[model samples]
Target: MKAAILLIGTELLNGAMIDTNSIYIAEQLNKYGIEIEYKIMVRDVIEEMEKAFAFAKKNVDLIITTGGLGPTDDDITKAAIAKFLKKKLVVDEKEKKELVKKYKDRKIEKKSNFKEIEKPEGAISFKNDVGMAPAVYINGIVAFPGFPNELKNMFPKFLKFYAKENNLKSKIYIKDIITCGIGESILEKRVKDIFTEDNIFYEFLVKDYGTLIRLQTKIENKKKVEKIVEKLYNKIADFIIGEDEERVETNIFKYLMAQKKPLTISTAESCTGGMIASKLVDVSGISASFKEGIVCYSNEAKIKRLKVKKETLLAHGAVSEEVAKEMVEGLKTDVAIATTGIAGPGGGTIEKPVGLVYIAVRVGESVEIIRKEFKGERNKIRQRTTLFALYSLLKMLSKRYDI
Candidate 1:
């Protein structure tokens, strides 16, 4: 089955709000062997909505819409669909009761919710479990509420309903290989052999944590798919960190978890401003390994907090590997990671340009410091710096523990 997504919102067109609904819908549809042929974003105008609808009917068999399903006057999704399908809009009695019960449960006595319960003629309206507004399945079009949480909650139910209604043959399968300690461009070149094979497809997404190689196939044989993944893994064995949904900190945390006793770790961040610590803390039960994180941005903080020598900062400047080395010395933990950088559009000279960063990793009795200069905006520079810090920590943990 082919699908098209129509995301309607003036806020999205104006850049005030981002439309994440299309991505969710496309991924969900793909799982059920539904190919998304087109994704369109239209402002809250009936003419534009009808145009999007007409285009979808010509190219796809199913249509999914998200957004503009609100109580406000600008919510014209139902009105536009009604006009396009030549169907009358009427109040869904069952949906009206759900809306009333929902309001009464919250002590709201207003009957204004009846307007929000309107549905297309002969449409199957699904009640929203998490928010106001309802999702509707009618005439080859499925409409979901614009709010992300509401749409997410209703998506699974819609999928079950779609499965019962239509018989599907193909099933989408996906495998992701997440790798770090290598550049995306270099990784792309490394995987040229995989892409060179006929009748196979791949996608490479470069992220701050790592580059993710997503492999998708509709072939019925599971062993054939496994063989493709194994070939890719063999090609990039040294660079691969983990599989789908795995992260740099996750891989490191798994290694630590395998040890007999938990090892405590600390961070001393400069331009990254505790981003490394934030990522590690995102993992649950990390308190067993992650001890503390501190952002010592100023020279005084580095000196007073992390015990960086004043003489070192004066000699090598704050953005040097020497200061990063001194910053990790004060941390009293099994391991310490420190970063100092110039992530900036300003504060740069000929000797020290923007994006110049130094990451220091200390494990047991050994310490390694790396100096790198990235090319990007301030935020990108900081993000890449944190990635290198985690990558370096992973490399050190592997060597020290032989995991």
Candidate 2:
């Protein structure tokens, strides 16, 4: 089935609010193999809303709208749809009673506030448990409240109702191979030959964590999908971090936690701030393996907190591999990761330009230091350093444990 989304709000057009509802709606519809052909954003003008309705009705099988459902005068979604369908607007008495009971203790003027319960004549109404507005389904269009929380709560019920009415079933099957320390172009070039099958499809998304290689097929047989996944795995086994929904930090956390003797880890960060530590901490129950993280941004802090030699900083500078090695080694954990880089629009010399990073991973008696040059703005450079450090540590541990 094909559908279109109409996001309505003057706030959205004027940059006062962001329309996250469309993204959520699209993801949910994609699971049912519903193709989204258009995403239209309109201001809170009735004329514009009517035009959008006409376009959606003429082009798509289904239409979904979010926003302009409120008690205020500008809330004209129901009015516009009713006018477009040549139907009369009437207040739902059952919904009005519920609203009156809900706000009984508060002093609210029913003459104006009860407009929240209005719907087009002969349209099916849906309750909003999270907010004051009532949603409606009339003539192939489903109207929802603009608030994200309310829309999220009401969407599932609408989906269930629509699925029963249309006899829709989940159609999209998906698998994701999350990998790190690899560029999208290089990974795609290596695996381009594996996508020859007509029944299977592939997509590559490069996120801050890494590049995610998505393998999908409409074919429902699990065994057939597994065969394709296994073949692709063998081709890029060394670069793969984990399977679907597994990030590099999560992979590292799980690997460390499953060890017979859990290895404790710590972090000493400079240019990346505490992003590496933050990612590890996001994984629940990681404290068993993650000890602590120290942000030694200043030269004095490095010398005092992580016990780096003052002479080393004076000779080789703080952004050198020597300091990164000392930073990791001084942590006194079974494993440690350290990063020092120049992520900036300024403060770079001919010797060390911006995006120059040194990462160190120390495990037991051995320490590995790497020098890397990345390109981007400040935050992007820092993000690259953080992901590279985590992936490097994971690769090292995987080899050590033969995972």
Candidate 3:
């Protein structure tokens, strides 16, 4: 059965609060074979909430909403749902008893938020173990509190109840083939004919390091999906980096950490401003292999820290292949990566233009530098360079022969 997720919060629409409830609920529902076809976010406004309910009811078999259940004046989710369903808002006596006992047990003062703990009439309600608000599953919509902690605590009980009622055991069939050192257009042209069948849903996405082929099939047969993945792998064995290619930075760090022999890596940054190093640090236990990261933004830093000579800088400028290579040469590690570029909106000249990036990869004794005139603004260029540097490092560690 299909489902729809509705997140009701004015703060979410105004960007003051991030709505993670939808993501969490969607993932949980997928475990029960409930596919979510629509994800919507509506403000705390009653009109918008009613409209969201109407749309979701028309679109899917199940509707789930988070937020608007808190003890505040803006907490109007039950009221909205009641209006939408033409029902009356009634106090839940059981939930009220629990709340009253909790207040007495804890010796806490009764507040305005406590009065808001009511459910819509004619609905199945689940007790909230961690909070005052009750989880109500009514008319295909499950409503939870706005707070993340309370929602997480209450969602599991709702999941079990819903699964028992629906009798669902879903199997997800998905694979992402990540290819490095290949352009998206070329990769698409090479493998376009492989997915001509009507049953497969495939997408070609361009990532910084390479292209990603996300293939999803509707059929849940494991053997059938495995055969398809195996066929596709055989066709693109030269480029496919497995599903971990989707999570490039983490995968790179994880692979490096799992090596039989420990390896050290160093970074020399220019236009990327230590973005590659920062990304590597984001992964847990990166210190196991990550040795050092240097942000040599200035020419003097390159000369002093990375031992880049002043002569090379004057001859080829900071954003050049020579400088990138020299920067790597100065670093001693199992793998050394370097970046030099002009990530800017105004640094273009007749000879050198903005978005000109030079990335260097040094694997053991071998070193290679790639130069590309990338497109986009400052932030985009830096981000692309950072991802490319990580991609290059992944190649050096995993596909040593390719480098």
Instruction: Write down the TM-score for model 1.
Output: 0.77
Worst 10 residues of 3 by lDDT: 238-247
Off by over 4 Å in 2: 8-11, 15-28, 44-58, 65-165, 260-263, 287-291, 401-403
Better of 1 and 3 by lDDT: 1
Candidate 1: give its CA RMSD in angstroms.
Answer: 4.6
Query: Of models 1 and 2, which has the larger lDDT?
Result: 2
Please report the candidate that would top lDDT against the real structure: 2
User: What are the per-residue Cα lDDT tens digits for candidate 1 across 135-182?
Assistant: 887889888879988998998888888888887643777777888777
- Give the lowest summed-lDDT range of ten residues in model 1: 192-201
Give the per-residue lDDT of model 2 (tens digit) for 1-403.
Answer: 9999999989988999988899779877876898999999998898999999998899999999999888898999988889989999888788888888667645555454677788889989888886788789988999999998899889988988888899998787777788877788999998888777777778998777789887776748456778778987899888888886678888887668777888899999999999999999989888898899999999999999999999999999999989999899889988899999899989788999999999999878789999999999999999999999998999888888643
lDDT of 3 at 50: 89
Better of 1 and 3 by TM-score: 1
TM-score of each: 0.77, 0.75, 0.71
